[model samples]
Target: MANIRPYKISISESQIQDLKTRLSLSKFPDELDNAGWDMGAPLADIKRLTRHWESSYSWKTAEAELNSLPHFITDIQCDGFQPLAIHFVHIRSKVQNAIPLLWIHGWPGHFWEGVKIMKPLTEGDGVEHPAFDLVVPSLPNFAFSEGTKERGFALAQYAETLNKLMLKLGYNEYVTQGGDWGTHISRALAHLYPQTCKATHLSMDAANPPSFLANPVLTLQHMLTPYSKREREGQSRTEWFTKEGRGYNLEQSTKPQTLGYALVDSPVACLSWIYEKLHDWTDNYPWTDDEVCTWVSIYWFSVAGPAASTRIYYETHHTTRTPENPRAVPRDMLRAYSPGVKLGYSHFPMDLVVLPSTWVRTLGNVVFERDHEDGGHFAAWERPGELVKDLRDMFGKKGGAFGCVKGANGYSQ
Candidate 1:
């Protein structure tokens, strides 16, 4: 059994002072006369955020709030990789039979992403909705978790780490919820361990248009079914992301090390890089300066450093590609059918990749799906209420995935 020890976040005073010092020394870049978001994070917004981050934002307060959660660390050794100290928040519901849920976060996101939905999902009247015992982890190379020095730590390695963590916690079977990199990782988990990973829920799933050769039934359904107004609008959003917003993906996937220098050396550069995504990705979600700073602070002071997070993009894309290897980049396989593990999707219109209903249905045994008109990529943060409701509905008594996990129906006795 892996030794699980309690953990607490404690960023040194020197690190705090150094961040402020770097912010003070940051050089401002000039922007076009009217180049709003289209040109990138506006100079004015970055300047304002920089000033707030340096002058008024409080890391101590945020750290305190983060530390209040049930933090723990354990050494999880993935195959062929050194043991990494994995930081996670494990909150067991009072309901004895609550479903064990592993909520994952992707790049530019950490374990803290589950903050909003943490409490609500874990506490519910047995009769109305089911409760969940939530385990939100800082993936290796993100947040307080340690990074891997060796290469080839792709999707399979990530899935392996999380699976081991769940097993160590005595959760032999579990379900997953995630978006962004979370969606990909969860899909990988389902594909790799269909028996243990019983069900999965995703907010940002990616899938190609159904082809007659692969999914003739779904392809026929896709051909006959006219795209809904919302699906059409979602395609437009996806196009905008593919054309205008995918430069970061290309850079990070191919040349993360080059970009790492900027992220690690300059706090301002790191802020600007992530701030653009936060601004562009969400659906007009109001962001306070403190909130923005706290989010970026987690990255700025992450155990593996801000640059380490970008390597996931590179590794997932560049890792060994083989038909037999389950760990290989899950490009076509994740979209392909995987039996046993039930699936659910919570579609948000403004997310980076928005696919039509019939298109995503080919992923697997999709039992539940919900479409929302008013959210973006960060569904857990932007629309926590809706996301939580979807989980409850999916696992509730009337839902398709109810009682999927053996002896853990998410309902009270």
Candidate 2:
């Protein structure tokens, strides 16, 4: 059993003062006239946000609101790595046999992303929509969790840590839900520990084009079928991301340390980097200054420091540079089929990478899929109700992944 202890968001007064001090002295960058969002996060918006962060945004109040949830810390050590003080929100359902659902978040996101759907997913009427025991973790090197000093703590290590955490918590078998890095991590979990990770519900998806040698039928189907309006739009969206929106990805993947100096040293540098994603990633979801501050604050004041979060991009990409590489098997297999775990996906039209149904089906035994007309990258945060509904429908008695976890049918006594 793991030695678990209760945890809280305890940013020191001095830390808060330092953050404010940085915000006060931030240097503003000039923007070209009529540049709009194409250039980046608007100068006016970042300036206003920086001012609000320095003045009106209360870290104490934000910390209290976050502390209201059940937070716990435990040491989870992966192979060849030192123990990480993993921070997670473990909320159990009243339903005795509720499904254990591990919600993994991606970059520019933390455990806070699951806050909106946590209670709703746990407090459901068991018969109508099965309840879940949610475990939302701050991945090693993010938020309040400790960072790893080793060179190669990639996806497999991440999957190992979470799997060990679940088993330590007495959940030998469980399902998963995630997007962004969450999607990749959950896929890693399924690929590596298929017997332990029974099923997965993903909000974001990435897949290689089906080849004649690998998926002849899928390729033929794709070739014959004309893309639907949504699929066409999704392709355009994907292209836009590939061409215009990938600068951050390239920098983070190839040379994170170069950018790390900026992230760790300047509060405004961190804010502008992430705030741009908040604006562009979502489908016109109006962001409050407070909301933006809290999101960025989690990164700014993260236990490992904001710079640690960016290394995941570098490590994962470098370790899995080639498909033949065995060190990171999930990188290749994530897009390939997984026979052991059941799969479900929620496709938000405006998500970063959206593909036609055939291309996605190559990943696994996809038992459920829902295509949303709206919403974007942050499915849980932006459209909690819809994301929750999709979960229920996917895991309900009539749905595909029902009773996947042994002895936990996601029902009340």
Candidate 3:
């Protein structure tokens, strides 16, 4: 058993100086006239951001704000992999029977994504809403957590590390909330350890159309029902992503190392790469300069170099490519339904992969579903109140997953 120790964020003065130096020496590429986001992150935007990052940004202030949160580090050892030092933010509710929820983050995102909802989730109004004990982990190789040296650390390993951490914290059974890569990871946790992961709530809905052979009832329903207005619009959005927005996926999946050099060497390269998604993936969320820099700074000062984060794409893509590991969860299984665990889905209009309600139903035993006119991939950060509300309603007294976790009804006696 690894001891859990209190942790704080304190980047050294030399690191801060080095970042400023890199920002000062950045070389930018020229763009065609009037080429906005169509040609990638605009030269003007990157230059302005680089200037601010070099001069005005205060990492010390950001560090102090992050330190105020309840941060901790623990060792989580997955089978065949060495013990990894996992960094996380754990907040226990005053309500004794609060639900234990594991919140995981995806690429280009860290534990800070959940900071907005932490207080509201744990300190819910006693009568109407439900409170929760939240456990947000910086997935290994993403942020402060230590990275893996060996190969084959795919989705299963990621799921295993999180499940063990929950068990180590005495959360014998729990629910989850996540988006982006998080959607896949939470589903993997439920599939691998159904007894421990009782339910999951997701923002991203990536599923294949129902098949007549495997999903007779769902296929029949799909044939009978015409697409709703929202569903029709969602298809157009999905088409746009498949055609225009998926270059990063192919690059990361096939040749992340080639691109890793740019991300590791240039601060602007890292910023522009992430900033583009933060712009396109969201539903017009206005981002400040400091906000963008702070988000990128986590990657700049990540425990593992920024390059390590992209390996998940390659590893997961090749997970079941060999014949020996036939049972390993592949791309298809990630979209397939896993019985036993309850599910909740939140659909956002601007998310990269937006599927219809029927398609999403094929993923699990879905009990709660909601569609929002706005918001996008970064659901928790863009719309914390809405995301938190979905969780509360899913686990509240009248929810489908009510009483799923023993004694964690999220109410006061």
The superposed Cα distance between candidate 2 and the true structure at residue 338, in angstroms, equals 1.2
lDDT per residue for candidate 1 within 1-413, as digits (tens), equals 45999999999999999999999999987777879899899999999999999999989999999999999999999978899999999999998878999999998888887899999988876669898899999999999999999988889899999999999999999999999999999988989988899999999958878888888998898889898776989878989998999999999999999999999999999999999999899999999999889999999999999999999998878766567564675566667787899999999989998888888788889999988878999999999999999999998888999999988975534
TM-score, candidate number 2 = 0.97
lDDT of each: 0.91, 0.91, 0.90
- Better-scoring candidate (lDDT), 1 or 2: 2
By TM-score, how accurate is candidate 1? 0.98
Residues 1-413, model 3: lDDT tens digits: 45999988889999999989999999999889889786688999999999999999999999899999999999999887899999999999988778999998998889998899999999976569888999999999998999999998999899999999999999999999999889999989888999999999999988888888888899998999998766889888899989989888999999989999999989999999999999989889999999999999999899988988999999899888357654367777788789999999989888998887888898889999988888989999999999999999899988898888887776734
Model 1 C-alpha lDDT versus the unseen true structure: 0.91
Report per-prediction Cα RMSD to one decimal: 1.4, 1.7, 1.4
Instruction: TM-score each candidate.
Output: 0.98, 0.97, 0.97
Predictions ranked by lDDT, top down? 2, 1, 3
